[model samples]
Target: MSANGLPTDRLGGNYFKLFGASTISNLGDGIGIIAYPWLASAVTRNPLLIALVAVVQRLPWLLFSLPAGVITDRYDRRTLMVIANSIRAVLTLGVALIVLGKQGVLPSPDDIDAGAVIGTDGFLYGMVLVATMLMGFAEVIYDNSAQTFMPAIVHKGNLEKANGRLWSIEQVANTFMGPPLGALLLIVAFSVPFFVDAATFVVSAALIALIPATKRSAKQTDLVERRPWQVELKEGFSWLWSHDLLRPMAIILGLLNMLGTLSGATLVLFAQEVLRTEPYEFALLESGGAIGGIIGGWSASRIARKIGSGPSLYLTLLLGGLTTFLIGFARNWIFVWAMFAIFMFFAVLWNVITVSLRQSIIPNELLGRVNSVYRFFAWGMMPIGAALGGLTVVLTDAFASRDIALRMPFFVAGVLSVALFFFAAPKLTTERIEAARTGSG
Candidate 1:
């Protein structure tokens, strides 16, 4: 038995290794969460340009998710994870070098918040865009494969436990530990965080590589005739679309994601201009999510059981709007931090229930493709939302104060989320979810 009183034998050695890799990589992601936006703000103050970086980073979900699903299904998933992280390490290293070369000319983070104007380095900004896009591609592969890879290492019964613990630790590393460290690194130099981020990727890649290969034997591969990519893709899509529950679930998630990015795309600016947060304060603000996520991750299963999956989801949607709307009106960082904590709590609740459901129901062979299609619908809208977020600020700025323009996205997102709750309430019921699970078995 583990310290938590759960049977350690069930989780297995490989799961821990995968867990370690995820934890390390997420810490880097946590650091990048601070570093990337701070770096963007230093490059330019234009809300649209800052939002553009977000759009480009998420664009791969829109453009590459389907193909990546196919790739995940075809390749050895562990190898795919290793290769993706290795590529990210090299790409991040290149970013560190580019930033190092140009750090002498870029405005300091302290200066940017004070309304200092700096001419954008076209080369550096372009590199940032290119690097983000590539990293996003790698992320798509790594994330999809990782999700599919989970069932291979751990039993289906323990998925929620495994995923919950995994996400909890990831949140701790990404939000709690990473952001503060990133803030300190930023104090030293812009290049320092990127270099550290690269190292994390290297370590994560090595850990994943150490896992035993999950490859099918030649006879197993030969037994199933390989179909064309288009056929396989269609099979995945058809299965998801034909399902009454999943089709709507995917659409509702897409809208929710869209609304999320609507406010989040320009949040760095809002923090700088409206909330008046410095790097340390911003890092502190992010830590709020970690606290919420830790609690949520540890308790999501209990919450779902107590309230039912459907009601849990409803709570997520309702709170999403409420928290975002509240955040828009706050002038203080502490208030925003509180809202972030609430927002992340329900966010993790939604993820724990839904992700575990999908993992439990989907056939292992098609899990990669179906999950990809699901994400394509769910995540593809982010770039569109990001673009709209930037446009909201620009258009609102024309008629309103900069502060109000920055706040508009949150108001708009909040309203949309409440509206989404009404639509989703009917489709994603407890009965439907249970019925689907029964039917799958």
Candidate 2:
């Protein structure tokens, strides 16, 4: 038995189930993540349209995240996970059917090159946009439920280890295995990848359903569901906003996400024009990050123990700045890939620390709502940043060449991340992290 008075075997067993479910779901996400933009690029070459697809997909974070959080706290988390995956499964199959119908009219996936499609059907573009939006909405619910669910399953002291394993497995599946396979599937048939994606979600839902029920806090039984959601929502917001450590972290994370998306929203174009990669090569580019993520996931806990959480955040920002700056000017595919690897390594380390910290600090009953509110600040800026990327291109089109304009967002992202690093590193001291850990902040 562990110190928490549960059998160590049972805890490990349950976490393995959760890890299995998450790994399968993210594996599917990795495939779809590649397929969606690939399909969008096929349907339209306009940078703004591509950005619009990204924007629409992320818009759910702005619209549904807070409410989703409340729903997560109010309902059975496992049930929510099942429902979210089921929604994704159905929607993804729908997209596959659409793609299958266009097999003759659409260019063969293998025949297409990296650059923009010459002309694409308007109807197809609309379908891609709508499908992506719906999938993103489902993802919002699933992710929030999944994150909050972690605390219920794992012992508090093991949060970092559990998180590291989860993050590493997710990265390996999403970036390392999924994308390259997706590119290969695309080579065989455009619709095949989507069908596989749909199947994975179905399997993931089943896996989640198999996880044993976790104990809920006694405090929750007294607070009936009939109470107003707004009251709880306000409590969540207040909790996050008032926390000295979480508030600054959330704000800085929000800015970083926005900046990251500004460049990421137009990555397909950059891969094509700057790196001059083919479909398979483009997928391989992501593998660099996957490799780095594996290392980061394994090392994050140890690094935090050595340097502390505050310094870990600082390191993430510094690495992120270096990544963006190099990618902005990198003409060689090798150079770009190396930079991506470095960036993702640190990104995973940062996630491990931050996620564990939140899981450790928040009261279980409030976890769902507060996690949602935190994401509202951190992720809400993604759509805005995506829009900024497209807008940057449009605004600069007249003054500079298309390639240069497309590259501008990367440079801007780099500059902003570096500036924030300087501002935040000083404010988020080691003392603050230690205070939060002790519940004294």
Candidate 3:
């Protein structure tokens, strides 16, 4: 529904402001996601090392994620967001300066890579890694708090719409502006987008500071004789494990994540080895999915209503897997590109639906810890999938053609996705969440 049609009584003013601020902050990160990874790939050709860039970036979610959840629960989430964004702004400023140096201050491609940065006598790869790690750390903190906080600001009825809008903004940030801006920034002034990104965070911090934190309910809130931090931390994890409904969903998301990452890692190989495309052209092929992601986010709410959230998840997940397999068999660049685009459309559509469904169904008190638990495994295995995808390429290359090596992962994930549907969906019923949402149980 349009903003005009929705009754003002159902949507709180503070909630809209909070989500709007989030959309802007997320847009900056989206640009960085494209810029940072491609920048790493361009300067360093080593597949394993390039993959390390993604690992170090995501590693924070594994290590600090649990602690971030604890902190989010104990403190003011609005203030926490401001602090996190401020720290990221400082880090982005540092990275931008380094880029500026590369453009002029260093003045020599000779000093670019191995001199002061990586110490390999010439690689800026080390600095790039540091920048990604910093941003990743900031993201972990911001996300943990936001997950918990957003649910508090809005009423139960608008939860799905709120989450869908957040995903939609992210789609624009990551998929829409990230590619063209990242590509153009690299060509014209590599440092420019980094500076602009830093500025966005600074602006986000300023805006977030204006909002007041949510008040906790003393009656319903848990009280512990021991230190609150210790209690809060364990409570989050305990709630997730003990809950019959959430446990299954968490496990399913983790397993699907592994499948998703496996397909993602193999995309490059498919484009380069199977389609015989250059890196730039391959990047374009990948960007087509980003477009699909944007479209998917826009449609998530309507689709969820039509199909119900659970069935929407099943169909999209299965369709994505089948199309991915078809992509592996495509004989030419045009066909492969067509398959990749459709693959992304379905994959992203699945993601938008599943994510909103989970967010809508889960308890707010358990949001941070549950999300962290979900991230710890769901996201924790991403690097492994990437590494394994690379390994499959390597091992397969040793025996078979590069095309076989590249397409192998697609087939594996296709099978996994299908299995997840059969094994998990029948058990995940709408009746399970109704009690939780109604609070009558």
Candidate 4:
């Protein structure tokens, strides 16, 4: 199916080029999660420090995402992506070099190698944070621009099918290949996956360069007519404000986003303290979720085609929440693996369905801006959720009971998803969705 929300004649043409680049970029992202955290944790065993790493990575979106979105709407998405990719490549290579030097694997840095690990007397943590922020800033720009660019490349009728394919590939890269392979490379060299990420960014940039669209012309724009950044930011939110299709889905996903964060942050604790699993075994258990996501991705397009996107989301999301709720009661290895797999499957379903709907309804002219606004909200609350989970353990007897601390986050995450389901269902109907898709086409 084409990516324009129309019926699929077939899936081919220029859109495939974007998919190729996305595959490479996504793999790097998945691998980054493993490599980055492991490197940081290797340096500092403190849970707070590990959590701080996540904070550094995600904080950029909350701060500058709106401006990044406006740029995507106002400029050449393809070119912005090229710049983002190139910059990411440089950062990844620099980090890789430093880590290699620290490990004494680089052989010849001599005096420089001594300064590599704790560079600038631990100032590199801040530098790493800054780089993470820039990388995230660029991510918001690239993601927004890509949303705008996708519909332009393919027909309107097949947005769901096309998005499904992309989601499937992302699931494979993220859940399947990223973690396991990253662990293997970490065994070989601490910075090996980062080096791979650097290479992928270069390749992604090259693939993005292959698209036929010309650079956006600044001369054609009316600079004086542009609204203030604050006003423009509000304008983007307002676009989704009165909409029938996107508004409800956004709220539903927003709650899940929060829940996902809480559940994710506490998962390692559950594995380590509750399940008594070895570190490597915990890694294997974690990968089970990704593997489940792969299965869900494989089936998602078929499910959506049979039941429709809105309905599929409605159903799978319920499953996702239930899975979260079930996490608290988990007792043994069997249950841990089962809950993880179930959680991953439903999460993948949620991702695939929502993306299809957004691509189908959002106007191409406003696509980048609207998506940026969506992301800023949908992703912005994750840090808060993480903090809340931490606090919940601190304030209550949750941690003392061990099980309470370990399981409460899961229950909260699940209930949040369930609560949002009712709020979303009445607003999201198959009829409205089909109409939106038809109108867009």
Candidate 5:
């Protein structure tokens, strides 16, 4: 038993190191959460341009996930994580410098509003696009490697517990602590938060570098032969496609992510215009997700055991539609806040269960490739969704009020989520999951 009376013997030093790095880096992400979107909104109120930033940011996942998987499988996972973060640090610093030079001309955070007619700062906007795309590529590699790296440090039996704890703290940093701080930093200057964000990446990279190298088993070594990239990629793709449960699950997640981006594509505008929120209030909006994520992360295992994995997932899908619809109709930021809290609770629940399930079932040698392929299905749709989301607003604005146009995506996404629940009901079940666990599926 550890100091908190929870088992710690099974979770060694490396797990804590990984946990700390994730937490600190997520703090930077939390800052970016406010800084990035707010910066885009300041540059141009055009919904398409704003959405383009998101599309470009996620484009790499679609383009690079398969190749990134191959790289993860080919290299040392820890070293890959360090290098990815280091690159991100460098790129973020460049953003800070660029923003510093232009801070004099950019609109003050307080003056930026949904109704403001601002000319697009082509130079800054282009830079945001390029930096986000590069960072997205780095994120793909770091994320794929990090997930695969987790299994090597912690015992398999403790995977759920470890993942749960990791996510909880990450949520706290990313949403709870970081956004409010980002809001404050914006008061100082746009570049200040980016500088802090860069520093956090540096710290995270150093921590990851300290983890001792993992020794591969003879079986894993033999399995991870130096094969052609195409062959290895095909192997991972075939494994996931052959699995009945994972195939549909990945597809379902892809649709869900698409729907999420659809509503979220123009969220900063919605918050500014529809909800009439200031920067601090907007940051407060994310706090709801932080709270929900914390609760869901800590309690997911218990919820899964109590309701069964199938029902837990059903709850996520069901609540996802309901909460999204509620947010569509909400005029007050507090109401939106409540919806965010509820929506994130189920979202984190889905992640905890699904991610843990994958880690438990997938073979070690194929973990990186398979997880990347799974993400390819899971995350690849985001850019597409982002594109549709932007188009949805622009097209809707032609016939309807801007407020109505802003709210349309949420309504559409809600209906799609409910329809998806019916489709997913039969495919994913507690029995199938248990059978897969026992190697009998």
Candidate 6:
């Protein structure tokens, strides 16, 4: 049986193990979403610093993603996943311990607006930053391995189904259930959520280790091993570049990610300052996106089938742009939650189709390398976006009110996303999708 209660034969028993591992890990990530920013906010009220914490977490994608791809291709992906999760467990435990030690001094959610605990100490912030960086490093390998690992366990036709289920569970774990749990944990004790997350990673790693080994080619591994890393890296880059649809998609996604992060990086401050969200309310705000993600995940295949994949993909860009643009104008937290939900809904839809397409299109031998290269471009922009988010607020603060400065990133991202729609719509035609589907690309 599987998550959806379908027979294991449809997706394979190994996929179920993968799904379980993803659920546990995503739950930990959900907790971190609350725990890291909450801890950061407790340390300082500087929007730039808050955003920098977010930046460091994503920085590994830029620095290590390509190499991660190479390793994913060469190794047993299951082993890599287990190792990555184990390391995450340790790093998260360190964070938990630090939080436990410092609970007496850390600020409550109420003190965030009062400026009482602001700029108190750098030691705790530095510790949080280091832990975040290490955890992110592990995530790079774990996520890369997980993506490549999926195609091995499920048949090509079931890629969409598998991805949809995986994404659905992850959203539920990370966003829906995780945030509220984090909020409650924070109310009880700051250290509790981190400790709970550490335990989840341990369980996640164990689940992954239980997965049976899938096939890998010794000849292919030898071929990759024989080549210089530069050559292997080039092969991945060249493959993506030569593919007309994938090339443009990666470029556009990279741009969108940069712009998206630009707005998203300062969300903690926006929620605190502009929306006036308390700790529990802030957690609920996080859950709003998860609600949409859950719906999108379940309906993705159906919607794509009804609308056609090209239009479905186009809809993501159009709706995501419009919703994000609207978020900039929101004065109320309820409005913010609504817009975030809508944006995430489209985002998940985009992910379901695109991820399945990539898995189905890329050859097994080259999947890891090509996927990594694609992410190197696609996700590599996140750190830059995170920095831009913080800078936009800080620089804009010189002239504008703090609230207005916080809104700048959302406005910029929205405008760029809308502009991208016109450029992408024509290029992302059904004919091109068919061409890729038929391997004509």
**How do the residues 81-193 of candidate 3 rate in per-residue lDDT, one tens digit apiece?**
89999999999899888877765533222232222242221346888888878878888888877766765666555766666666666666665556556555555566777
Higher-TM-score candidate among 1 and 5? 5
Q: Better model by TM-score, 4 or 5?
A: 5
Among residues 3 or more apart in sequence or in different chains, the pairs in candidate 2 whose N, CA or C atoms overlap within 3 Å are none
Model 6: ten consecutive residues of lowest lDDT: 1-10
What TM-score number comes out for model 6?
0.96
- The deviation in Å at residue 350 for candidate 3 is 5.1
Candidate 1 residue 326 C-alpha distance from true site, Å:
0.7
Mind giving the per-residue lDDT tens digits that candidate 2 earns over 248-277? Answer: 888888899999999899898788777777
TM for every model, in the order presented, reads 0.96, 0.97, 0.83, 0.84, 0.97, 0.96
The residue ranges of model 4 lying beyond 4 angstroms of the native Cα positions read 1-8, 104-128, 214-234, 276-283, 331-334, 396-404, 439-441
lDDT of 1 by residue, 388-426 (tens): 999999999999999999999999999999998998999
lDDT string, candidate 4, 1-441, tens digits: 433343357656567888999998888877786666556534543344444555656666677666777777677788888888888899889888878767543322122212234212254455455666677767767777777677666566666567767777876776567766776777677768889988988999999999876444353254215666566667778888767677766666666777777776646556555666543455466666776777777787787678876787777668778878887787765676777788777677777666766776776556666787777777777766666665555444433675676667778888888887787777667777777767741
**Location of the lowest summed lDDT over 10 successive residues in candidate 4:** 106-115
Residue 392: error of model 4 in Å?
Answer: 3.2
255-295: candidate 5 lDDT, tens digit per residue: 88988888898999989999998888889999999999999
**Cα deviation of 204 in candidate 4 (Å)?**
1.3
For every candidate in turn, the CA RMSD to the true structure comes to 2.9, 1.6, 4.9, 5.5, 2.7, 2.7
Q: How close is candidate 3 to the true structure, as a TM-score?
A: 0.83
TM-score result, candidate 4: 0.84
lDDT value, residue 420 of candidate 4: 75
